[model samples]
Target: MHFPTLATPFIFGATALAASLTQVSNYNNNAKAKPGMWVYKPDTVKSDALVIAIHSCQSSAQKYFANSKIPWHQGSDRKGYITVWPSSTTECWDVSSKASLSHDGGGDSNAIANMIKYAITTYKTDPKKVYVTGGSSGGDKDADELFGMMSNVLAATYPDLITAVSLYSGVPAGCFVSSSGASAAWNNTCSGGQSKASGEAWGNVVRNMYPGYTGSRPRMQFWHGSVDGTLSPNNYQETVKQWTNVFNVSTTPTSSKPDTPEKNYRTDDFGSNVEGIWAVGVGHSVPSHLDVSEAWFGL
Candidate 1:
């Protein structure tokens, strides 16, 4: 999946890049990951939205900022929003933990929630406009390392803290979890895309995260590469089934077409609040779709 360069080219020079990232030392006290936080504030304040961008395994926040094709900093500057990046001190995010899967449960998810609150208060960002996006390890389902755990776990554990989330190759919230509240370090069942369940069953997993929350559920977007052996495309299909049932929308997409002129880069709009993108020959981390994300986020 190729993420086309946006019509607005990236113009941030070395000085801007140098001035962009600021280290945030205090966000959470109990996170197992003990993640390091980094913030990017746009030069012009056009929007009050905040975006949390999580990094993949074997990657640091600084590396993600410098190398991710998603253009997070560029989007922050152009859209006049704040972007937060969290670097897990551990080998990976604590997505495969019982605590991380539960709301207010002390783990990486709680740490991320604290980070969001910190950013919102410190930056005066709109609490209602908070969003999240991530890719592989951080955003996907991998057999050896549990790739897609971050976005799924965070969104499930703290729906109220986020307005929406875009996941690249992510599985359902409880995909890495077993029935006994135990988490798998590597769940081949889910990673192979065999973690199938009824839409209601999967939806219940998300609802169980909060138990009794009555507020609106955050919207979601999914991106998957059809040929991605690392995290099979079946996970994406299951994700669509889960959210569609959560929204009480039909399983059938209202609209389906090529996202770009590219033949296999198809998009299926399930409803106003849910969308899925399928890339034919793409692999592990689906191509960055910041342009579509900006519009979805209303940035």
Candidate 2:
């Protein structure tokens, strides 16, 4: 595949991108907001929307931000966005840890929410443009926990703040059942393989996140390789179904191909809220066209 040119989003003011990159940490809540790498283009600003790029299992924030081989850093420095890469306390997101299953959620997931809080207050990030996404397990960490359980689980738990969410090679909530059980919410460890749930079943999971949800729910996107080995590619379909159901999107996609092609695409609107893209021949990796992923967020 060819490397993406990545010149889509209009460039912002110089103040935004003045610093090519910097390290910021929330000392007030140091435990929650891990020392994350902040990236900006040459002309970006504080009001620009933020992309919280989460890492895959056994990966670090530094690797995605500065890794020479991966183009993640390259597209990350494009024109219209500011990027944040926060490290996980454990090798993977706390998805498998027993503590992650807790009612208040494990440290890793809660910390990510805190990171979002820090970004909004400190960087003046656009709340409506804020997006959360990751590669592999990082994509949808808390989806496998339970149905309408109201656990303050992963970053998705704060849908009240996030405008949109996208996942790559990930599963939906309750996709896997934990071995430790409800009493041991602290344990992230799980015992089952992927537990398939229909779109309606998982939609109920998202609705349960907020005790009394009223406003617009987070928009959703799903991108995965047809040949993903780390996680089943079919899971993307389930994730799309869940998000679409949550947003009340059409059962069949509004549009598909070239614009949202069988490979390398951006799907038609799912009621102006949800979309899915597929990358053929790609594996358990981040979509090569980081620019397209950003565009999915309407950035």
What is each predicted model's overall lDDT from 0 to 1?
A: 0.78, 0.55
Cα lDDT for residue 280, candidate 1? 82
Error of 1 at 104 (Å): 0.4
Instruction: Give the runs in model 1 whose Cα sits over 4 Å from its true position.
Output: 1-18, 28-33, 135-147, 178-184, 259-262
Q: How do the residues 230-273 of candidate 1 rate in per-residue lDDT, one tens digit apiece?
A: 76678888898888988889889999888552567988889898
Question: Stretches of candidate 2 above 4 Å error?
Answer: 1-21, 30-47, 69-76, 96-106, 135-155, 181-194, 258-269
- Per-residue lDDT tens digits of candidate 2, residues 60-152? 666555555434445555545667676654544554333343323534555666667777777677778877766433223323212111121
- TM-score for candidate 1, please give it: 0.87
Q: List clash counts for every candidate, in order.
A: 5, 20
Query: What TM-score does prediction 2 earn?
Result: 0.73
lDDT assessment of candidate 2: 0.55
